[model samples]
Target: MSALAPDPRFVSQAPGPGQRSPFLRRLAHASEPWLYSAPALILIVAVMLVPLVLGISYAFRDVRLLNPFSGGYVGLQHFHELARDKAFWGALKNTLWWTGASVFLQFFLGLFLALLLDKPFYGRGIAQALCFLPWAVPSFLSGLNWAWLFNPVVGPLPHWMVSLGLMSQPENILSDPTLAMWGPIIANVWWGIPFFAITLLAALQSIPRDLYEAAAIDGAGGVQRFFSITLPFLAPTIAITVLLRTVWISNFADLIVVMTSGGPANRTQIVASYIFTQAFKKLDFGYASAVALVLLVLLLAYSMLIVLLRQSLLKKG
Candidate 1:
Protein backbone atom coordinates (compact mmCIF):
# COMPACT_ATOMS: atom_id res chain seq x y z
CA MET A 1 0.00 0.00 0.00
CA SER A 2 1.14 3.49 -0.83
CA ALA A 3 2.07 5.51 2.25
CA LEU A 4 -1.04 7.19 3.60
CA ALA A 5 -0.87 10.87 2.99
CA PRO A 6 -0.44 12.55 6.39
CA ASP A 7 -3.72 14.06 7.60
CA PRO A 8 -3.42 17.82 6.99
CA ARG A 9 -4.85 18.76 10.43
CA PHE A 10 -2.71 16.19 12.30
CA VAL A 11 0.56 16.82 10.48
CA SER A 12 3.36 17.97 12.74
CA GLN A 13 4.60 21.36 11.73
CA ALA A 14 7.46 23.49 12.95
CA PRO A 15 6.21 26.06 15.48
CA GLY A 16 5.79 29.40 13.73
CA PRO A 17 6.87 32.63 15.31
CA GLY A 18 4.17 34.38 17.38
CA GLN A 19 1.49 35.52 14.93
CA ARG A 20 1.00 38.83 16.89
CA SER A 21 3.29 41.70 15.95
CA PRO A 22 6.46 41.61 18.08
CA PHE A 23 6.33 45.34 18.71
CA LEU A 24 2.73 45.15 19.95
CA ARG A 25 3.53 42.24 22.24
CA ARG A 26 6.59 43.95 23.63
CA LEU A 27 4.70 47.18 24.24
CA ALA A 28 1.85 45.39 25.98
CA HIS A 29 4.21 43.44 28.20
CA ALA A 30 6.18 46.51 29.15
CA SER A 31 3.06 48.59 29.83
CA GLU A 32 1.18 46.05 31.95
CA PRO A 33 2.39 47.23 35.35
CA TRP A 34 2.09 50.88 34.46
CA LEU A 35 -1.45 50.34 33.28
CA TYR A 36 -2.37 48.79 36.60
CA SER A 37 -0.68 51.57 38.58
CA ALA A 38 -1.84 54.54 36.50
CA PRO A 39 -4.75 55.52 38.78
CA ALA A 40 -2.64 55.58 41.90
CA LEU A 41 0.14 57.49 40.11
CA ILE A 42 -2.33 60.06 38.85
CA LEU A 43 -3.95 60.50 42.25
CA ILE A 44 -0.58 61.01 43.96
CA VAL A 45 0.48 63.54 41.36
CA ALA A 46 -2.72 65.49 41.69
CA VAL A 47 -3.00 65.47 45.47
CA MET A 48 0.50 65.28 46.90
CA LEU A 49 2.96 66.24 44.20
CA VAL A 50 1.01 69.21 42.95
CA PRO A 51 0.47 70.65 46.43
CA LEU A 52 4.11 70.07 47.32
CA VAL A 53 5.29 71.93 44.26
CA LEU A 54 2.89 74.78 44.93
CA GLY A 55 4.01 75.03 48.56
CA ILE A 56 7.65 75.11 47.45
CA SER A 57 6.86 77.85 45.01
CA TYR A 58 5.11 79.80 47.75
CA ALA A 59 8.34 79.70 49.74
CA PHE A 60 9.95 81.98 47.15
CA ARG A 61 6.97 84.28 46.74
CA ASP A 62 4.76 86.38 48.95
CA VAL A 63 1.39 84.64 49.19
CA ARG A 64 -0.39 85.89 52.27
CA LEU A 65 -3.96 84.83 52.81
CA LEU A 66 -6.72 87.35 52.02
CA ASN A 67 -4.36 89.62 50.13
CA PRO A 68 -5.19 90.14 46.47
CA PHE A 69 -1.72 91.45 45.50
CA SER A 70 0.48 89.30 47.74
CA GLY A 71 1.83 86.71 45.31
CA GLY A 72 5.03 88.63 44.65
CA TYR A 73 8.46 87.03 44.27
CA VAL A 74 10.27 87.47 47.58
CA GLY A 75 13.44 85.37 47.03
CA LEU A 76 14.75 84.01 50.36
CA GLN A 77 13.28 86.81 52.41
CA HIS A 78 11.28 84.29 54.41
CA PHE A 79 14.38 82.27 55.20
CA HIS A 80 16.15 85.43 56.37
CA GLU A 81 13.22 86.15 58.65
CA LEU A 82 13.18 82.58 59.97
CA ALA A 83 16.87 82.82 60.84
CA ARG A 84 16.33 85.84 63.06
CA ASP A 85 13.15 84.61 64.68
CA LYS A 86 13.72 83.53 68.30
CA ALA A 87 10.44 81.60 68.38
CA PHE A 88 11.48 79.52 65.37
CA TRP A 89 14.68 78.48 67.13
CA GLY A 90 12.71 77.57 70.27
CA ALA A 91 10.21 75.57 68.23
CA LEU A 92 13.04 73.71 66.49
CA LYS A 93 14.47 72.66 69.83
CA ASN A 94 11.06 71.60 71.07
CA THR A 95 10.54 69.53 67.93
CA LEU A 96 13.73 67.60 68.65
CA TRP A 97 12.72 66.85 72.21
CA TRP A 98 9.18 65.87 71.24
CA THR A 99 10.22 63.58 68.43
CA GLY A 100 13.11 61.95 70.28
CA ALA A 101 11.35 61.19 73.55
CA SER A 102 8.13 60.06 71.89
CA VAL A 103 9.87 57.73 69.42
CA PHE A 104 12.12 56.14 72.04
CA LEU A 105 9.38 55.57 74.60
CA GLN A 106 6.97 54.23 72.00
CA PHE A 107 9.51 51.84 70.46
CA PHE A 108 10.60 50.32 73.75
CA LEU A 109 7.12 49.90 75.15
CA GLY A 110 5.85 48.54 71.86
CA LEU A 111 8.69 46.01 71.67
CA PHE A 112 7.95 44.84 75.18
CA LEU A 113 4.27 44.49 74.36
CA ALA A 114 5.08 42.63 71.15
CA LEU A 115 7.29 40.19 73.02
CA LEU A 116 4.57 39.52 75.54
CA LEU A 117 2.02 38.96 72.78
CA ASP A 118 4.24 36.67 70.70
CA LYS A 119 3.78 33.78 73.09
CA PRO A 120 0.59 31.71 72.95
CA PHE A 121 -1.81 32.63 75.71
CA TYR A 122 -5.51 32.46 76.49
CA GLY A 123 -7.54 35.46 75.22
CA ARG A 124 -4.65 36.52 72.98
CA GLY A 125 -7.00 37.86 70.35
CA ILE A 126 -8.89 40.04 72.80
CA ALA A 127 -5.70 41.26 74.43
CA GLN A 128 -4.20 42.27 71.12
CA ALA A 129 -7.38 44.07 70.12
CA LEU A 130 -7.54 45.98 73.39
CA CYS A 131 -3.92 47.05 73.21
CA PHE A 132 -4.29 48.22 69.65
CA LEU A 133 -7.54 50.10 70.25
CA PRO A 134 -5.72 53.35 70.96
CA TRP A 135 -4.49 53.47 67.39
CA ALA A 136 -8.02 52.98 66.10
CA VAL A 137 -9.18 56.25 67.67
CA PRO A 138 -8.77 59.36 65.53
CA SER A 139 -5.61 61.35 66.27
CA PHE A 140 -7.56 64.52 67.01
CA LEU A 141 -9.87 62.67 69.36
CA SER A 142 -6.93 61.13 71.15
CA GLY A 143 -5.38 64.55 71.52
CA LEU A 144 -8.57 66.02 72.95
CA ASN A 145 -8.97 63.10 75.31
CA TRP A 146 -5.46 63.46 76.62
CA ALA A 147 -5.94 67.16 77.02
CA TRP A 148 -8.98 66.45 79.13
CA LEU A 149 -7.02 63.94 81.15
CA PHE A 150 -4.49 66.62 82.01
CA ASN A 151 -7.16 68.93 83.36
CA PRO A 152 -6.94 69.21 87.10
CA VAL A 153 -10.63 69.86 87.54
CA VAL A 154 -12.09 66.92 85.64
CA GLY A 155 -9.12 64.55 85.26
CA PRO A 156 -7.73 62.12 87.83
CA LEU A 157 -4.06 62.30 86.82
CA PRO A 158 -3.33 65.47 88.72
CA HIS A 159 -5.19 64.22 91.76
CA TRP A 160 -3.35 60.91 91.63
CA MET A 161 -0.02 62.71 91.46
CA VAL A 162 -0.99 64.85 94.39
CA SER A 163 -2.10 61.82 96.38
CA LEU A 164 1.23 60.14 95.66
CA GLY A 165 3.04 63.23 97.04
CA LEU A 166 4.58 63.92 93.65
CA MET A 167 2.87 67.31 93.51
CA SER A 168 2.06 69.98 96.04
CA GLN A 169 -1.45 70.22 94.68
CA PRO A 170 -3.61 69.07 91.82
CA GLU A 171 -2.41 71.28 88.99
CA ASN A 172 -2.57 71.26 85.26
CA ILE A 173 0.90 70.41 84.04
CA LEU A 174 -0.16 71.69 80.65
CA SER A 175 -0.05 75.23 82.09
CA ASP A 176 3.47 74.91 83.45
CA PRO A 177 5.91 75.96 80.72
CA THR A 178 8.76 73.91 82.14
CA LEU A 179 6.63 70.76 82.13
CA ALA A 180 4.14 71.53 79.36
CA MET A 181 6.00 69.75 76.59
CA TRP A 182 5.85 66.53 78.53
CA GLY A 183 2.07 66.50 78.42
CA PRO A 184 1.94 66.31 74.64
CA ILE A 185 4.87 63.91 74.50
CA ILE A 186 3.11 61.58 76.89
CA ALA A 187 -0.03 61.66 74.79
CA ASN A 188 1.92 61.01 71.61
CA VAL A 189 3.67 58.01 73.10
CA TRP A 190 0.43 56.51 74.33
CA TRP A 191 -1.19 56.90 70.93
CA GLY A 192 1.85 55.71 68.95
CA ILE A 193 2.82 52.65 71.02
CA PRO A 194 0.17 50.50 69.42
CA PHE A 195 1.53 51.25 65.95
CA PHE A 196 4.97 49.90 66.81
CA ALA A 197 3.45 47.00 68.74
CA ILE A 198 1.36 45.92 65.78
CA THR A 199 4.25 46.18 63.35
CA LEU A 200 6.76 44.42 65.63
CA LEU A 201 4.22 41.76 66.54
CA ALA A 202 3.77 40.94 62.88
CA ALA A 203 7.52 40.85 62.37
CA LEU A 204 7.91 38.66 65.44
CA GLN A 205 5.28 36.21 64.17
CA SER A 206 7.07 35.87 60.84
CA ILE A 207 10.20 34.52 62.58
CA PRO A 208 10.73 30.78 62.16
CA ARG A 209 9.75 28.98 65.35
CA ASP A 210 12.21 26.29 64.28
CA LEU A 211 15.08 28.68 64.82
CA TYR A 212 14.08 29.26 68.42
CA GLU A 213 13.57 25.57 69.00
CA ALA A 214 16.98 24.78 67.53
CA ALA A 215 18.65 27.47 69.56
CA ALA A 216 17.05 26.20 72.74
CA ILE A 217 18.05 22.64 71.95
CA ASP A 218 21.62 23.92 71.55
CA GLY A 219 21.52 25.28 75.11
CA ALA A 220 20.71 28.91 74.30
CA GLY A 221 19.10 31.02 76.99
CA GLY A 222 16.05 33.21 76.42
CA VAL A 223 18.19 36.35 76.49
CA GLN A 224 20.70 34.80 74.11
CA ARG A 225 18.06 33.78 71.63
CA PHE A 226 16.49 37.23 71.68
CA PHE A 227 19.80 39.01 71.26
CA SER A 228 21.18 36.76 68.54
CA ILE A 229 18.17 35.62 66.54
CA THR A 230 15.21 37.79 67.37
CA LEU A 231 17.09 41.06 67.35
CA PRO A 232 18.86 40.38 64.10
CA PHE A 233 15.61 39.55 62.38
CA LEU A 234 13.89 42.58 63.91
CA ALA A 235 16.63 45.15 63.26
CA PRO A 236 15.35 46.13 59.84
CA THR A 237 11.77 46.54 61.01
CA ILE A 238 12.82 48.56 64.03
CA ALA A 239 15.02 50.86 61.99
CA ILE A 240 12.41 51.60 59.36
CA THR A 241 9.64 52.13 61.90
CA VAL A 242 11.76 54.40 64.07
CA LEU A 243 12.87 56.50 61.11
CA LEU A 244 9.35 57.01 59.81
CA ARG A 245 7.95 57.66 63.28
CA THR A 246 10.60 60.27 63.97
CA VAL A 247 9.63 62.22 60.88
CA TRP A 248 5.93 61.93 61.67
CA ILE A 249 6.29 63.00 65.27
CA SER A 250 8.39 65.98 64.29
CA ASN A 251 5.62 67.14 62.00
CA PHE A 252 2.85 66.30 64.44
CA ALA A 253 1.35 69.37 66.08
CA ASP A 254 -2.27 68.43 66.63
CA LEU A 255 -1.88 67.38 70.23
CA ILE A 256 0.13 70.47 70.99
CA VAL A 257 -2.35 72.68 69.21
CA VAL A 258 -5.31 71.26 71.04
CA MET A 259 -3.69 70.85 74.44
CA THR A 260 -1.53 73.92 74.89
CA SER A 261 -1.81 76.03 71.74
CA GLY A 262 1.98 76.36 71.95
CA GLY A 263 1.87 77.02 75.69
CA PRO A 264 1.94 79.23 78.65
CA ALA A 265 4.74 80.87 76.64
CA ASN A 266 5.27 78.86 73.46
CA ARG A 267 7.18 76.25 75.44
CA THR A 268 5.50 73.45 73.52
CA GLN A 269 5.59 75.12 70.13
CA ILE A 270 7.18 72.65 67.79
CA VAL A 271 7.99 73.78 64.25
CA ALA A 272 4.81 72.13 63.06
CA SER A 273 2.62 74.00 65.52
CA TYR A 274 4.46 77.20 64.72
CA ILE A 275 3.69 76.69 61.07
CA PHE A 276 0.03 76.32 61.89
CA THR A 277 0.07 79.45 64.00
CA GLN A 278 1.66 81.39 61.18
CA ALA A 279 -0.63 80.30 58.37
CA PHE A 280 -3.87 80.13 60.27
CA LYS A 281 -3.52 82.58 63.13
CA LYS A 282 -1.33 85.17 61.49
CA LEU A 283 -2.47 84.50 57.90
CA ASP A 284 1.09 84.59 56.54
CA PHE A 285 0.95 81.73 54.06
CA GLY A 286 4.23 82.70 52.43
CA TYR A 287 6.14 82.67 55.69
CA ALA A 288 4.42 79.44 56.74
CA SER A 289 5.37 77.82 53.44
CA ALA A 290 8.97 78.94 53.87
CA VAL A 291 9.11 77.49 57.38
CA ALA A 292 7.55 74.26 56.07
CA LEU A 293 10.20 74.06 53.33
CA VAL A 294 13.00 74.40 55.87
CA LEU A 295 11.43 71.68 58.03
CA LEU A 296 11.01 69.46 54.97
CA VAL A 297 14.69 69.87 54.06
CA LEU A 298 15.78 69.05 57.62
CA LEU A 299 13.60 65.91 57.68
CA LEU A 300 14.94 64.86 54.27
CA ALA A 301 18.51 65.25 55.52
CA TYR A 302 17.69 63.25 58.64
CA SER A 303 16.12 60.43 56.56
CA MET A 304 19.14 60.32 54.23
CA LEU A 305 21.50 60.09 57.20
CA ILE A 306 19.49 57.24 58.68
CA VAL A 307 19.48 55.35 55.38
CA LEU A 308 23.23 55.77 55.02
CA LEU A 309 23.85 54.62 58.58
CA ARG A 310 21.66 51.55 58.05
CA GLN A 311 23.49 50.69 54.82
CA SER A 312 26.90 51.07 56.48
CA LEU A 313 25.86 48.91 59.42
CA LEU A 314 24.48 46.28 57.05
CA LYS A 315 27.78 46.24 55.16
CA LYS A 316 29.72 45.84 58.40
CA GLY A 317 27.51 42.92 59.41
Candidate 2:
Protein backbone atom coordinates (compact mmCIF):
# COMPACT_ATOMS: atom_id res chain seq x y z
CA MET A 1 0.00 0.00 0.00
CA SER A 2 1.11 3.57 -0.67
CA ALA A 3 1.92 5.58 2.43
CA LEU A 4 -0.88 7.91 3.50
CA ALA A 5 -0.24 11.55 2.53
CA PRO A 6 0.58 13.82 5.54
CA ASP A 7 -2.44 15.91 6.60
CA PRO A 8 -1.83 19.54 5.59
CA ARG A 9 -3.62 20.85 8.70
CA PHE A 10 -1.21 19.00 11.08
CA VAL A 11 1.94 19.90 9.19
CA SER A 12 4.28 22.56 10.66
CA GLN A 13 3.76 25.90 8.93
CA ALA A 14 7.14 27.43 9.70
CA PRO A 15 7.92 30.93 8.41
CA GLY A 16 9.78 31.32 5.12
CA PRO A 17 13.15 33.15 5.06
CA GLY A 18 11.39 36.30 3.73
CA GLN A 19 8.78 36.29 6.52
CA ARG A 20 8.91 38.34 9.73
CA SER A 21 10.52 36.85 12.84
CA PRO A 22 8.20 35.62 15.65
CA PHE A 23 9.59 38.32 18.00
CA LEU A 24 8.93 41.05 15.40
CA ARG A 25 5.36 39.76 14.87
CA ARG A 26 4.70 39.71 18.62
CA LEU A 27 6.16 43.21 18.98
CA ALA A 28 3.90 44.53 16.24
CA HIS A 29 0.87 42.89 17.87
CA ALA A 30 1.80 44.39 21.25
CA SER A 31 2.16 47.86 19.70
CA GLU A 32 -1.30 47.82 18.10
CA PRO A 33 -2.99 49.40 21.13
CA TRP A 34 -0.38 52.16 21.30
CA LEU A 35 -0.79 52.84 17.61
CA TYR A 36 -4.56 53.07 18.05
CA SER A 37 -4.17 55.54 20.92
CA ALA A 38 -1.26 57.45 19.37
CA PRO A 39 -3.33 60.45 18.33
CA ALA A 40 -4.86 60.95 21.78
CA LEU A 41 -1.47 60.43 23.47
CA ILE A 42 0.16 62.93 21.14
CA LEU A 43 -2.59 65.47 21.76
CA ILE A 44 -2.32 65.04 25.54
CA VAL A 45 1.45 65.47 25.44
CA ALA A 46 1.20 68.56 23.26
CA VAL A 47 -1.67 70.24 25.08
CA MET A 48 -1.38 69.19 28.72
CA LEU A 49 2.01 67.64 29.44
CA VAL A 50 4.08 70.15 27.48
CA PRO A 51 2.32 73.14 29.00
CA LEU A 52 2.62 71.61 32.48
CA VAL A 53 6.36 71.05 32.05
CA LEU A 54 6.96 74.50 30.60
CA GLY A 55 4.96 76.11 33.40
CA ILE A 56 7.00 74.23 36.03
CA SER A 57 10.23 75.27 34.35
CA TYR A 58 9.01 78.85 34.20
CA ALA A 59 8.58 78.80 37.97
CA PHE A 60 12.35 78.52 38.29
CA ARG A 61 13.07 81.22 35.74
CA ASP A 62 12.44 84.94 35.28
CA VAL A 63 10.09 85.02 32.31
CA ARG A 64 8.64 88.48 31.97
CA LEU A 65 6.35 88.92 29.00
CA LEU A 66 7.61 92.33 27.96
CA ASN A 67 11.29 91.68 28.52
CA PRO A 68 12.50 89.29 25.78
CA PHE A 69 15.92 88.77 27.39
CA SER A 70 14.57 87.96 30.85
CA GLY A 71 14.75 84.20 31.00
CA GLY A 72 17.35 83.69 33.72
CA TYR A 73 17.00 80.80 36.15
CA VAL A 74 16.12 82.16 39.57
CA GLY A 75 15.73 78.93 41.53
CA LEU A 76 13.32 79.44 44.48
CA GLN A 77 13.44 83.23 44.49
CA HIS A 78 9.87 83.45 43.31
CA PHE A 79 8.71 81.09 46.05
CA HIS A 80 10.65 83.07 48.63
CA GLU A 81 8.97 86.23 47.44
CA LEU A 82 5.66 84.44 47.48
CA ALA A 83 6.27 83.47 51.08
CA ARG A 84 6.71 87.11 51.99
CA ASP A 85 3.99 88.47 49.72
CA LYS A 86 1.10 89.83 51.75
CA ALA A 87 -1.05 90.19 48.66
CA PHE A 88 -0.48 86.54 47.79
CA TRP A 89 -1.42 85.55 51.32
CA GLY A 90 -4.58 87.65 51.13
CA ALA A 91 -5.45 86.16 47.77
CA LEU A 92 -4.94 82.67 49.19
CA LYS A 93 -7.37 83.49 51.99
CA ASN A 94 -9.91 84.80 49.50
CA THR A 95 -9.42 81.63 47.43
CA LEU A 96 -10.36 79.45 50.40
CA TRP A 97 -13.45 81.55 51.10
CA TRP A 98 -14.43 81.79 47.44
CA THR A 99 -13.99 78.07 46.80
CA GLY A 100 -15.72 77.08 50.01
CA ALA A 101 -18.75 79.35 49.65
CA SER A 102 -19.32 78.73 45.96
CA VAL A 103 -18.92 74.96 46.29
CA PHE A 104 -21.17 74.74 49.32
CA LEU A 105 -23.96 76.84 47.85
CA GLN A 106 -23.75 75.15 44.47
CA PHE A 107 -23.77 71.63 45.89
CA PHE A 108 -26.71 72.12 48.22
CA LEU A 109 -28.81 74.04 45.71
CA GLY A 110 -27.99 71.55 42.97
CA LEU A 111 -28.91 68.65 45.23
CA PHE A 112 -32.20 70.34 46.07
CA LEU A 113 -32.97 70.92 42.40
CA ALA A 114 -31.99 67.36 41.55
CA LEU A 115 -34.28 66.02 44.24
CA LEU A 116 -37.11 68.21 42.99
CA LEU A 117 -36.63 67.25 39.35
CA ASP A 118 -36.37 63.55 40.19
CA LYS A 119 -40.01 63.40 41.21
CA PRO A 120 -42.78 62.83 38.65
CA PHE A 121 -44.22 66.23 37.93
CA TYR A 122 -45.74 68.26 35.13
CA GLY A 123 -43.40 70.00 32.70
CA ARG A 124 -40.38 68.42 34.35
CA GLY A 125 -38.41 68.63 31.14
CA ILE A 126 -39.06 72.32 30.76
CA ALA A 127 -38.28 72.96 34.40
CA GLN A 128 -35.02 71.03 34.14
CA ALA A 129 -34.06 72.99 31.03
CA LEU A 130 -34.76 76.29 32.72
CA CYS A 131 -32.82 75.26 35.81
CA PHE A 132 -29.80 74.28 33.72
CA LEU A 133 -29.97 77.38 31.52
CA PRO A 134 -27.38 79.32 33.53
CA TRP A 135 -24.83 76.56 33.06
CA ALA A 136 -25.21 76.62 29.27
CA VAL A 137 -24.42 80.33 29.17
CA PRO A 138 -20.73 80.98 28.61
CA SER A 139 -18.93 81.97 31.80
CA PHE A 140 -17.76 85.22 30.23
CA LEU A 141 -21.31 86.08 29.32
CA SER A 142 -22.56 85.05 32.72
CA GLY A 143 -19.99 87.29 34.34
CA LEU A 144 -20.97 90.21 32.14
CA ASN A 145 -24.65 89.60 32.71
CA TRP A 146 -24.20 89.40 36.45
CA ALA A 147 -22.07 92.53 36.32
CA TRP A 148 -24.83 94.36 34.52
CA LEU A 149 -27.39 93.03 36.95
CA PHE A 150 -25.35 94.34 39.86
CA ASN A 151 -24.89 97.73 38.25
CA PRO A 152 -26.60 100.43 40.31
CA VAL A 153 -27.35 102.69 37.38
CA VAL A 154 -28.32 100.28 34.61
CA GLY A 155 -29.55 97.14 36.38
CA PRO A 156 -32.65 96.50 38.51
CA LEU A 157 -31.02 94.15 41.00
CA PRO A 158 -29.49 96.98 43.04
CA HIS A 159 -32.82 98.79 43.12
CA TRP A 160 -34.60 95.57 44.05
CA MET A 161 -32.11 95.01 46.84
CA VAL A 162 -32.70 98.54 48.03
CA SER A 163 -36.49 98.08 48.04
CA LEU A 164 -36.09 94.74 49.82
CA GLY A 165 -34.08 96.50 52.57
CA LEU A 166 -31.03 94.40 51.73
CA MET A 167 -29.17 97.56 50.83
CA SER A 168 -29.43 101.17 51.94
CA GLN A 169 -29.59 102.53 48.41
CA PRO A 170 -29.06 101.62 44.76
CA GLU A 171 -25.37 100.82 44.81
CA ASN A 172 -23.25 98.32 42.95
CA ILE A 173 -22.28 95.56 45.37
CA LEU A 174 -19.38 94.74 43.04
CA SER A 175 -17.79 98.06 43.99
CA ASP A 176 -17.99 97.42 47.71
CA PRO A 177 -14.89 95.69 49.06
CA THR A 178 -16.89 94.17 51.89
CA LEU A 179 -19.57 92.81 49.58
CA ALA A 180 -17.66 92.50 46.28
CA MET A 181 -16.66 88.90 46.86
CA TRP A 182 -20.30 87.88 47.19
CA GLY A 183 -21.15 89.14 43.69
CA PRO A 184 -18.74 86.75 41.99
CA ILE A 185 -19.54 84.00 44.45
CA ILE A 186 -23.25 84.33 43.71
CA ALA A 187 -22.64 84.30 39.96
CA ASN A 188 -20.33 81.31 40.23
CA VAL A 189 -22.87 79.39 42.28
CA TRP A 190 -25.58 80.20 39.73
CA TRP A 191 -23.43 78.97 36.84
CA GLY A 192 -22.00 75.98 38.72
CA ILE A 193 -25.16 74.64 40.40
CA PRO A 194 -26.29 73.14 37.11
CA PHE A 195 -23.11 71.07 36.95
CA PHE A 196 -23.89 69.45 40.28
CA ALA A 197 -27.55 69.18 39.37
CA ILE A 198 -26.77 67.33 36.15
CA THR A 199 -24.29 65.02 37.81
CA LEU A 200 -26.37 64.38 40.94
CA LEU A 201 -29.52 63.93 38.89
CA ALA A 202 -27.79 61.30 36.80
CA ALA A 203 -26.59 59.60 39.96
CA LEU A 204 -30.05 59.80 41.49
CA GLN A 205 -31.64 58.21 38.44
CA SER A 206 -29.18 55.31 38.65
CA ILE A 207 -30.47 54.42 42.13
CA PRO A 208 -32.73 51.40 42.26
CA ARG A 209 -36.43 52.09 42.73
CA ASP A 210 -36.65 48.66 44.37
CA LEU A 211 -34.37 49.85 47.13
CA TYR A 212 -36.72 52.69 47.96
CA GLU A 213 -39.69 50.32 47.84
CA ALA A 214 -37.91 47.89 50.12
CA ALA A 215 -37.12 50.66 52.54
CA ALA A 216 -40.74 51.79 52.50
CA ILE A 217 -41.97 48.24 53.20
CA ASP A 218 -39.52 48.10 56.09
CA GLY A 219 -41.39 51.16 57.59
CA ALA A 220 -38.74 53.70 56.55
CA GLY A 221 -39.95 57.25 55.96
CA GLY A 222 -38.79 59.53 53.16
CA VAL A 223 -36.07 61.20 55.22
CA GLN A 224 -34.96 57.88 56.68
CA ARG A 225 -34.66 56.30 53.25
CA PHE A 226 -32.70 59.25 51.97
CA PHE A 227 -30.27 59.12 54.87
CA SER A 228 -29.86 55.35 54.93
CA ILE A 229 -29.98 54.45 51.23
CA THR A 230 -29.93 57.47 48.96
CA LEU A 231 -27.01 59.15 50.71
CA PRO A 232 -24.88 56.03 50.78
CA PHE A 233 -25.58 55.35 47.12
CA LEU A 234 -24.79 58.95 46.22
CA ALA A 235 -21.69 59.20 48.41
CA PRO A 236 -19.20 58.16 45.75
CA THR A 237 -20.70 60.51 43.20
CA ILE A 238 -20.82 63.35 45.68
CA ALA A 239 -17.18 62.90 46.66
CA ILE A 240 -15.97 62.91 43.08
CA THR A 241 -18.15 65.82 41.98
CA VAL A 242 -17.20 67.90 44.99
CA LEU A 243 -13.51 67.27 44.37
CA LEU A 244 -13.78 68.20 40.69
CA ARG A 245 -15.81 71.32 41.42
CA THR A 246 -13.43 72.38 44.14
CA VAL A 247 -10.46 72.08 41.82
CA TRP A 248 -12.22 73.83 38.96
CA ILE A 249 -13.55 76.64 41.11
CA SER A 250 -10.17 77.13 42.71
CA ASN A 251 -8.77 77.79 39.25
CA PHE A 252 -11.70 79.85 38.01
CA ALA A 253 -11.07 83.59 37.61
CA ASP A 254 -13.31 84.71 34.79
CA LEU A 255 -16.15 86.10 36.87
CA ILE A 256 -13.78 87.94 39.17
CA VAL A 257 -11.86 89.38 36.25
CA VAL A 258 -14.90 90.39 34.28
CA MET A 259 -17.00 91.61 37.18
CA THR A 260 -14.67 93.06 39.77
CA SER A 261 -11.20 92.78 38.28
CA GLY A 262 -10.25 91.70 41.81
CA GLY A 263 -10.77 95.27 42.79
CA PRO A 264 -12.01 97.88 45.23
CA ALA A 265 -9.33 96.53 47.58
CA ASN A 266 -8.58 93.12 46.05
CA ARG A 267 -11.26 91.53 48.21
CA THR A 268 -12.34 89.20 45.44
CA GLN A 269 -8.81 88.31 44.40
CA ILE A 270 -8.44 84.53 44.51
CA VAL A 271 -5.18 82.82 43.62
CA ALA A 272 -6.30 82.35 40.01
CA SER A 273 -7.04 86.05 39.56
CA TYR A 274 -3.77 86.79 41.32
CA ILE A 275 -2.01 84.62 38.74
CA PHE A 276 -3.69 86.55 35.95
CA THR A 277 -2.69 89.81 37.54
CA GLN A 278 0.94 88.74 37.74
CA ALA A 279 0.98 87.29 34.24
CA PHE A 280 -0.84 90.08 32.39
CA LYS A 281 -0.97 93.26 34.42
CA LYS A 282 2.43 92.84 36.02
CA LEU A 283 3.95 90.96 33.05
CA ASP A 284 5.62 88.56 35.52
CA PHE A 285 5.04 85.26 33.80
CA GLY A 286 7.65 83.47 35.92
CA TYR A 287 5.97 84.56 39.14
CA ALA A 288 2.57 83.72 37.76
CA SER A 289 3.83 80.24 36.85
CA ALA A 290 5.24 79.87 40.34
CA VAL A 291 1.85 80.75 41.85
CA ALA A 292 0.22 78.29 39.47
CA LEU A 293 2.69 75.59 40.53
CA VAL A 294 1.87 76.24 44.16
CA LEU A 295 -1.85 75.98 43.39
CA LEU A 296 -1.21 72.73 41.49
CA VAL A 297 0.66 71.24 44.45
CA LEU A 298 -2.09 72.28 46.86
CA LEU A 299 -4.82 70.84 44.61
CA LEU A 300 -2.85 67.61 44.19
CA ALA A 301 -2.53 67.23 47.93
CA TYR A 302 -6.24 67.90 48.36
CA SER A 303 -7.13 65.33 45.68
CA MET A 304 -4.89 62.71 47.27
CA LEU A 305 -6.50 63.29 50.64
CA ILE A 306 -10.01 62.97 49.18
CA VAL A 307 -9.06 59.77 47.32
CA LEU A 308 -7.54 58.24 50.43
CA LEU A 309 -10.61 59.13 52.45
CA ARG A 310 -12.91 57.61 49.83
CA GLN A 311 -10.83 54.45 49.71
CA SER A 312 -10.96 54.18 53.48
CA LEU A 313 -14.72 54.62 53.43
CA LEU A 314 -15.05 51.98 50.72
CA LYS A 315 -12.89 49.54 52.67
CA LYS A 316 -14.98 50.11 55.77
CA GLY A 317 -18.16 49.64 53.77
Q: Which candidate is the best by lDDT?
A: 2
Question: What is the overall TM-score of model 1 with all chains considered together?
Answer: 0.88
lDDT score for candidate 2 against the true structure: 0.91
In candidate 2, what are the lDDT values of residues 65-154, reduced to their tens digit?
A: 899999999999999999999889999999999999999999999999999999879999999999999989999999999999999878
- Models 1 onward score TM values of 0.88, 0.89
- What C-alpha lDDT, on a 0 to 100 scale, does residue 125 get in candidate 2? 91
Candidate 1 local distance difference test against the native: 0.90
Candidate 1: tens digits of C-alpha lDDT, residues 1-317:
12434445433452246444444455689999999999999999999999999999999999988899899999999999999999999999999999999999999999999999999999999999999999988888888898889899899999999999989999999998899899999998999999999999999999999999999999999999999999999998898788878888889999899888898788999999999999999999999999999999998988898888778867876
User: Residue 157 in model 2: shift from native, Å?
Assistant: 1.2
Give stretches of model 2 more than 4 Å off: 1-13, 16-20, 306-317
